[model samples]
Target: MLTPTVVSNSTVRRSSRTPAANARTSTRCSNCAMRHLCMPQGLTVDELPKLEALICNARSVRRGDFVYRAGDPFENLFVARSGSLKTVMAHRDGREQVTALRLAGDPLGLDGISTGMHTASAVALEDSSVCIIPYPALKHMCRETGAMQDRLHRLMSEQIIRESSQMMVLGSLSADERVAAFLLDVSERNGQRGYSHAEFNLRMTREDMGSYLGMTLETVSRTLSRFQKRGLIDAQGKLIRIIDLESLRRL
Candidate 1:
């Protein structure tokens, strides 16, 4: 019942103030830049159109907008078609935690699958766009397509692995080690997306980083300064450059 705008590739660059119901596009999944990451593999030429037909819509989310709030109905799974997003969970006592950072090519809304409602809120980190895959339709397709079913299973398994790794980072790593691993993880993800892994802009603020890394804001700032002094990194405001990759890894 959620009625976001159906956008094509050309319709994605509208003003941030544009209402979601006002825009439209004809872009197809076959031509999407993120197909390599979001699409199932080994589909025949004839089968490609069926997937494209199901994924004809996308929605743009302006920075700081909530893509979907916690407790919202789980109607669609989203792939980050462009830009970044962060998933956050709110405590009953009013505290919030950054649960995960999602970049382009990453999937969102899986958290809702278990309960038929979202457990956390997804917010855009920048002016981002998401390709919407209606879950009921996708579930139906998966029932008929072996490749699609396999891809869905693999995506779910990868989410489990990521959650396990986050637990490991929080439970065992020191503050310095935690920060190092965070940077390395971001670098690797950027590399995977064909960007320069050695340097990239961090869209999140220091406080958000602290929330995600389980460090105090002061501690996060101090650690970054220490890394700069040690020649482990060069950070200018939001831009970060990993100067000593091997040394950072050794941490």
Candidate 2:
């Protein structure tokens, strides 16, 4: 189970990578690269150790494997430690929609909080790894101090902001406008994670992108071709280079 069950000091607090059997390990929050973008961002140095004690290391998830499924019990929140994953929601008519794409350093499983069960399913888009944050342990930890409590609220606020942005994309944008915005958004987010903003590969398929943007796959293709003809972007297979970010934003 990815859900947290905080063991006593005699358990996970032992020296790491020991030769003994039954050894359990946790990552240090102070040393995490994503600490500033994650729930532990505001934790002080003194409080970092406490936060570290709450996270449990996890094994890698293979491509096409599911991290969790809709209707499953919500025990933990998942962080994309490496690679990427997609969240899917199934329609009553049996169609599935890709709700979101999660990259390294991104958080997942937040939608499970409302009903204590997951509302969407997460599948690894590539071989991936996740940090499992035990929800029970996290909630208990939040109650122990003020900083983490505020951090929890901030995390939720960010989620709300992301949801709002997604809503705007779906409700207001035209097909070409949607693709333009999607590329720019992904590029900006990728840059934040230390990748090249203007040049990168598209991890999501055209079909997935169309699903996210509420456009048909053919529409996505035509729009890209149009963007290419206009010199707004250069697409060679899955790789894309935005030649005119200003034009894209204007679109």
Candidate 3:
């Protein structure tokens, strides 16, 4: 069984120290901010020293960078520190689908755990930084640390559950329900990151949102317009402000 650890927000903040300083001080390890979400929930003082040494090399990627392309060899686990990313799948016919949109604190590339190769391409939707935890180093830590292994299992399980739920939502929900549920879901997730749940931005485009929601672009635009007219939401291009969260939930 995996034990859940509660990492303090402060500890997470401390992980984002610059690489230069992180190389010198085990106590002041870098990548804390990004690791907050992906790392074990709570870490003891003893564990921190070992973890800092294992996670020595780190890099930053800007918007539009391809973290990894589909079919690429996978060697590291990626954690989004800030901004958003989209995993896309392109067919031989030139059709493209936006499979997933990940925000700050979300982990990507775990879906390739079994295959050892990425199934979709991960690209930053905005200026972003990601912490790359090499698989060998991570595996070594997990083998030596019970808590670290537990955290890895929990993360993998969570990913499975989320993907399963998304499939169910796509299969069973009506168009209106899907759109409404998507808005509510995004709002709640954003809220977790300390942003206003009712008033925040939509980083993905309408077409991409429609693709994820299993609706056409026209339907997405029309539905959004209806929400605006009904005062359910206020959206201007990518900026969406949820005016009536309750009503959105009820829908």
Candidate 4:
């Protein structure tokens, strides 16, 4: 029912992952730019190398690649190193809904922890890479290390908070307001990653955005067009420039 936990923009995100999963050493947690957004956020210098060793390696994903499908065994926790991902929940009738749009540094595959089976599937939105954190190792680290344990708890709390916020966006906001909210969400996420707050490209498609916002594709396009005409935003295809951040926020 909720869109997802936005991982947002990442720094040092491109540097990060793997050896045990047949992945080579691409980057380590101690040196990753996106470490702030993932498990390495609170670990001390001495603790970083220990955490890094828990990851066997990184994996490469092309656009449209499935990171994991629903019902897959929950084994590893994935962190996006580059590019973006979307977590989707499919229905019985072959329809699916976008549950989350994951940016660089977002952790994927955590939902499987409760049942030991993935509740949703993840797909890469672009040419991307992910650090595959071995679950057993991660759990061991959590038990033995206070920093890892605290970060794990914090990440879980973050997931709850984001879902709650998305519920509010869906429950009370008007169509225009919803679109405004969506834009603001993306902008804020980008800013958090140290990217330009006022300008960025949208990775999700119009249909995807509509699905996430619970609006029609036409409504999503129309609302964006209206925003452009009103000087609230300037859009050329997927690239967007927020011209009136205050007004958008006020909505």
Candidate 5:
């Protein structure tokens, strides 16, 4: 399971942006790291310049900023350039359930496509920058370009696969198994984003973890303690070190 860390006040900072010196001119498009990820896989040089014009670099969000809330009109697809984000849904009874935790290089707000409104709230878990791809422009591109259509299909397919995995986790696994599976999943995703797979910081709280795993906060705590006692993981407050990855996988 992921452990929550109490970050010091000094680590938090507000999102800020300053005007670019060459704001009036179009910039070169070859250097963008998210080019292939945000757009189609095989965009031609002729198409890139137009795509660049539609994209705007935005300020980084601090750790508690809401990117967008549930019920907000969908405007853009946010591609995380750095740090992490948590997507949550709230119940009528006032309980919040964490739906997904996104890392750098993941796309946010895709769920808005079906309803034309955000289905969940997205909040930054750390200082993060997101490339805003306006939805109208993207829709136009997808209709006009075959490559964009293929990319959108691939993205939707990926979402389906993830949702299927989540259903299996929630419906079939025990509390301890769920926690173990979640940590391993997070570790693998973190590794994909160029961080250490087995060792990295966890930003979500125990309550949030419990919500995601469909368990009470106390059950979450008990499971973590049991894992620690069995030498599967070491927890010192929020800092957790995985000691038995194979055992965790077995659970």
Candidate 6:
């Protein structure tokens, strides 16, 4: 069982109880803003109640705190209800490598399903909240509803695709190409979630981005500067704007 922490104001405390245990109300899947991203598209009237009951808890994590650490026993999966987080794995030498960035509507802990233990730690990039979906209850619901089972399979497929893309980026791309690809990828993802794709704040620090892209911090900074100088992008601190989308796509 994973023990998730919740933040109230600036105070951090651990909790073993479900998130709904101390709450007045929980968001129902049918009415949630992120429903389109995580919920099954076609559900019968009978299935909606089961889906809502499956996600009875919601956790609030402060910035810099972990949602779940690597190696923790996996009891539930999570959906990012708001804000963002990064999943990282620790090396034998004690260095942590950033593996994936999770935005609002993204699923976390899918990597744990096979091993029954989390493979990476998920830390909040900013103050974030996640809707907790207990896997045992979810599996029971899946057995009862084919739509729910299909949704779970789709989430797993998406995780695999993201990992494959990262491998390709790290293995074949030059530093410049890698950075461009990263920016483009972020842009597309933001657009998918109904945010401004051309301009958005990149919450990840340059150092963290470097770790995820398999580049040095200096290399990441230098490449961004080069992109800005070439009029391909306008970057101010962590805010990035794609100035020439066509030109960036070609790179």
Task: Compose the digit string of candidate 6's lDDT tens values, residues 79-114.
Answer: 999898999999999999999999999999898888
lDDT on C-alpha atoms for all candidate structures:
0.84, 0.80, 0.75, 0.80, 0.75, 0.85
Clashes of each: 1, 1, 5, 12, 0, 0
* Candidate 3 residue-wise lDDT at 67: 75
What is the Cα-based lDDT of residue 135 in candidate 5? 81
lDDT of 3 by residue, 1-251 (tens): 33222121222234557565455433224445545566675678889778766653334456667777777776777777778988888889977788888887787788667798878888876666665566777899899888899988988888788778889889998787788888898998887777789887787888888888778999999999998999999998888999988988888
TM-score of each: 0.90, 0.87, 0.84, 0.89, 0.83, 0.92
Ranked by lDDT from best down, the candidates are: 6, 1, 4, 2, 5, 3
- Model 2 pairs in collision: 4-134
Kindly report which residue pairs in candidate 6 clash with one another.
none
- Model 5 clashes, total count: 0
Q: RMSD for all candidates, in order, please.
A: 5.2, 5.3, 8.2, 6.1, 6.2, 4.1
Name the lDDT value of residue 131 in candidate 2.
Answer: 77
Q: Rank the candidates by TM-score, best first.
A: 6, 1, 4, 2, 3, 5
- Model 1 lDDT, full chain set: 0.84
The CA lDDT at 210 in model 6 is 99
Model 4 regions more than 4 Å off: 1-23
When summed lDDT is taken over every stretch of 10 residues in candidate 3, the lowest stretch is 3-12
Model 5 misplacement above 4 A: 1-39
Question: Which of the two, 1 or 2, has more TM-score?
Answer: 1
Model 1 per-residue lDDT tens digits across residues 78-157: 88989998999998998999989999989999998899988998888888988877788899999988999999999999
- Quote the lDDT for 43 in model 4: 65
Worst 10 residues of 1 by lDDT: 4-13
Q: What clash pairs does model 5 have?
A: none
Candidate with the greatest TM-score versus the true structure: 6
